[model samples]
Target: MDNMFRLMGSEEFSDRRRCIWVNGPVIIGAGPSGLATAACLHEQGVPFVVLERADCIASLWQRRTYDRIKLHLPKNVCQLPKMPFPENYPEYPTKRQFIDYLESYANRFDISPQFNECVQSARYDEVSGLWRIKTTTTSSIAGSEMEYICRWLVVATGENAERVVPEIDGLTTKFEGEVIHSCEYKSGEKYRGKSVLVVGCGNSGMEVSLDLANHNANPSMVVRSSVHVLPREIFGKATFEISMMLMKWLPLWLVDKLLLILAWLILGNLTKYGVKRPNMGPMELKVVTGKTPVLDIGAIEKIKSGDVDVVPGIKRFYRNHVEFVDGQRLNLDAVVLATGYRSNVPSWLQENDLFSKNGFPKSAFPNAWKGKSGLYAAGFTRKGLAGASADAVDIAQDIGNVWREDSKIHKMRSRVVYRRCISLA
Candidate 1:
């Protein structure tokens, strides 16, 4: 660490900022994606510096996610590039288990990210042919401004860097209830027997409603638009695993039809309960738009048993109640916006060509990993952890090739310099 970070003279910088030189790429975020990329780089004998805004690794999982969250996909699919989940872990590891695994992965790869170092801005320096990353550290030794110069920059912050809470009419002003995003939600224990409104019908919304119902809270879920809710498993097989396998042999349209049929057989008609299906199939929709379908575990049963009310979009909120768009009104004690999260790339990174305004790779999947001027993205793939692992492998290999060639040239130059010195003597 000392060798990598030496304070530069004041004249070298416009603001007298401390500068650290990274031998290879500077990976932003210590989340699973970043760890995976670092691991792959290590395997390729590449040195890297990881920068994290939070105090711990995978801050989204460590702090933001609800307590009840689990790996939506199977453990095999969710595992990082080199390490697999422990044998004792279940098919769907809980949030805590996942965090433990990520920590272990980092240790295995000797990846020690500089935590609490929030990136203020990162831009490519055309003159230096490098990246200039400015950051502010916020630890016990806080308030230190630092700039990282690197040959490459890896944006491993992933897709869900920040939470999204939609603006609703009279929600903040008139509604005299506790309002919180799903990221802040931990559990449903405190709201037992209280009326709760859950906005958004995605996986988080469904699971939260189920949790509230289990805790004896009267949870009314707001399902405003069409959604695809598929059974998590079919006939003792994981639906996601099945989709991945079938995708190899069948057309996407056919796979969608088969999966929907299986889902219908297992879940039955959900229309009666106010959940409408989208015209686009689940997989197709996920590919076209980055919308993932809800993989039902227990929420469907709760919604069916009338324990959880399915309401329409909220029209407006009163002092202690909410009016639905369908002209119905219901009382509530709290509101949980399971409205999900979004990428925060555009806010920090200054590159305009690689990432779109929405903070995703402008290029579509299978081609989104690499960008211009030594910029790479990991975990932006809507395909989830598996996609991230793929990105990690490819990134390491690409960087590794260039690094090896540079090393060879440096060695040759060093040998020439040594011979010249000997001859001069």
Candidate 2:
């Protein structure tokens, strides 16, 4: 079943100095937490190997999102563990039906992921305890290089892996138009009537300014500070299922004062449509700053029906307008930015104390999936796909208890090398 997601032939991986030793667990990023850690290490029979840099398998929901994204959480809290999304999908599943339910949950667990192969460097040998990695494969023919040597690595490259772009002091030579970065946006069909802007109010700058105001463009957004928008439904269910039933029967400051009085009696006073509200509470700023509460899927009724338009942050960028910091300006022809994404995991971890100068993982939510030495990480727990299916069932039961104590020390070192080859016969 693992013809490594089929389509092999380049004389099959075209041996670039063949060195595929797997033992078990290598994972990197076939997305959706590396196919939920390859369906929990193929249900613990183990022998893993995912890799994917993206030729398929949920390449950030197949090709970096937006064409009207979706799954702003639902589909029963974004399933994965026993693979669920289909039963007539749509509690909010769009990015191409969540990339066709992640290619049918990687062919219902046959899970072959090599894909475009990227990893480019892993390192962690310390006298061969094992984890070398080093990938790179233009999918064979004129480009190839591989090397694995596993025994447990798992990263799952989750935190978007780069795309924050915000240093705006005239974003590199006064915007003359078309800047883009909501991961290279998608529809707004060549920005129809054109005007764009979008910057960042999170949730991909309020769903790409309500998809450039339902594709007639003119958009706007920006906001830049104070957020927490949430509202993909309120009494009719799913405001993240009533904030997970008030965070499972109230407490964290009474589930942030009852979801801030049910988001001020259902999203009213969005600072009278200039949108400000951020004195914390959106489940306490997603529990003290993981920050991600902009779920209002209709983009606040297209920013209160002015067909988007909010502005407030960027104070520079001229050659045709963009000075805001509330001093006001305008003229924009295109901007996008939707400003978000980080975690490149210090570009292949040269072990800077297992991260956290903001590069994340210093062990927090559900123990950031165990990362010290043998390293683990899976989906960086921003709680997407229920925290990457509970960090792929606790990293497949901690790599099936280190593959059963390394198979009982390789059967007691093969019975002490058969009693030293029967005392050298």
Candidate 3:
């Protein structure tokens, strides 16, 4: 891998082709997908330099996520290639453990990405067959705007780039107390002993509420809808094992019903605490179809124990008071919104009409853009917590296959790219 990077890095680049350093392929986002893709590319003799927007690797882990977060997937299945967590680590690593694992992975793979440099825009130059990438950051030794011209561009930026704060009516104008997005959440110490409202029941929501409960914060979870909340460890085995064993054969509807029934039998209505299990089927197919298991986080248990209060969705907020859809109102100290995130592709591409109708850059696999430019996207979709690991495997496999094919045709093509410029401008 080192030999490959050295070889590619030494290649002579055109000075006229100013964009990237013209070292090798350019990768955006130094999160899990970026690191994994870099590892595979290194092993396969592909040279790439990763551009990160944060001050360190795994910024999401170190910055965005809350304390006490744990991987829902078991450690074994979620392990990365060529790098595994130490045996002494927990079966399901905590947020800190995960950060250590990623840091170790980056070190082992020799992925010294330039930190604090955020990519602003990237465009493919058809005439030069190079990708022109621009950035806004102080880290670049070359000064303000750095450029890179490369044959390929790989976007390893995962889906969790931008937090999805909902545009609630009167939220900005009326609300008073501390209102923060999930991405800004660091700990629950501030909410301790205070009435807190946590919106969203996804893994983040569950974990946050539990943390607040553990801290005796008296937090209340606002569940807007129904979701399948499964035990992380079921019957001394990972719930994914059960899901794989049972969910595959049974129809989705049946599986949803069965899981709900089982949860009800074990956990009860959950409504008294304010959580309502859907009567029909799973709200999202992503949960029902995939074997990704949701952690219960004992939020229901917290509610049952009266540590955490479960409440309906927020109807409105006035000063330090909150109104719910149930026509109930309460005064709260803080509101932590666990609302999800949107995939933020760099600006250059966004302005060029590159994304699909769904906002994802159009590509089938590892490659995000299915054009002759060889631009690919590594991870722009959220599969789960283990999504980083899962996506790494798939992207590595695809990049390997694509690189092999490109290598074979490398010598057959003309050295210079001559493209007739068409005026779309």
Candidate 4:
């Protein structure tokens, strides 16, 4: 208790007369992006602290996955800057292994986080030009609260925390079977011989279906639209390894289109297998609309082999049956919604109108907005989960530049236009 209070509220002076302030200059989540951001800050000798709602870093990955869950991208591309993963691990690290990696990462950087500290509210104080952060410590703290007046706020809380379950009609009154979101999912052992409907075809949904099949569960996947499917490996190398190499040389749009074309050529007429080719241009973070394609998990093979069933989207639900949009009803013993998540930021920041109506922060750059006092948003956009690493690289330089009071920040004030491109087609 005494140490925790001292770390957050008290300060010590360094030899160079550098005032190592106790107040947090940055508060980051303990996820991948958050860890990368903190690592960069530490390297720069920045005074910051990370607040994790869970007992450790990567808690979401620890809690919100079925058994046998593996990383969609390979370790070479997913790793934080300068931290090489262990050679013994597979190309795609499993959930437990990844959690262990995050632990190793924090320890390697000597980032001793204030575990079990969940940030409840974060507000910007205009008069003091700092962010007033409020957080509740875990049971060990006996409900004692802590406050921080930080110079900046980095939201590494990815968009995957709040699950987006479908609003089925009469679900509460009619359905008698168990319904669970992917977040609460742990394993498929209980449904060893029962029938189940796994909704959504994203990475999580496909992975869940695969696990159920392995456990002898008759899992039917419900696909609402089409997805671009790519293999984990091509020509004896991980796909993401190829992607990271290409992303450095080519533009994002060009890379996406080229990859999409390559996937179609390799996979062929995806519609026959319930996968759809997007009618839009290359999938980029800038075009933050509609669903992206799925990474192939051999689940489609399970579907063809009669181990899993592919059905249309859900329209309604009865006691143990789910009706699809095509007027087809199927009997199911359990339902697993693999739908994605949304950002659920606390009210303290939301009340400031810092976020766009779509719930994302309005500006995203060195100077995203005009005349807003010392508030920053990093790791908000998703360009694959490793986007956090990308954000860390950009943000560290940006923040360091800001703290140094560099003249370059003023050069882009009139030239940069951080406007959203509206799609009419």
C-alpha root-mean-square deviation, each candidate = 2.6, 16.8, 7.8, 11.4
TM-scores for all candidates: the values are 0.96, 0.39, 0.83, 0.81
Q: Model 1, 210-259: lDDT tens per residue?
A: 99999999999999999999999999889999998999999999999999
TM-score of 3: 0.83
> What is each predicted model's overall lDDT from 0 to 1?
0.92, 0.79, 0.71, 0.71
Worst 10 residues of 1 by lDDT: 1-10
Model 4: lDDT to the true structure: 0.71
User: Model 1 residue 70 lDDT?
Assistant: 92
Candidate ranking under lDDT, highest first, comes to 1, 2, 3, 4
Best-first order by TM-score: 1, 3, 4, 2
Clashing pairs in 4: 226-276, 228-293
Report the lDDT tens digits of candidate 3 across residue range 15-56. Answer: 334434445677788888888878877777767788898889
Best by TM-score: 1
| Winner by lDDT between candidate 4 and candidate 1 | 1
Q: Please write out the lDDT profile of model 4 over residues 96-211, one tens digit for every residue.
A: 88888888988887777667777778776554455666777775736766665566777777666567987887466798988999888788899999898898888888888988
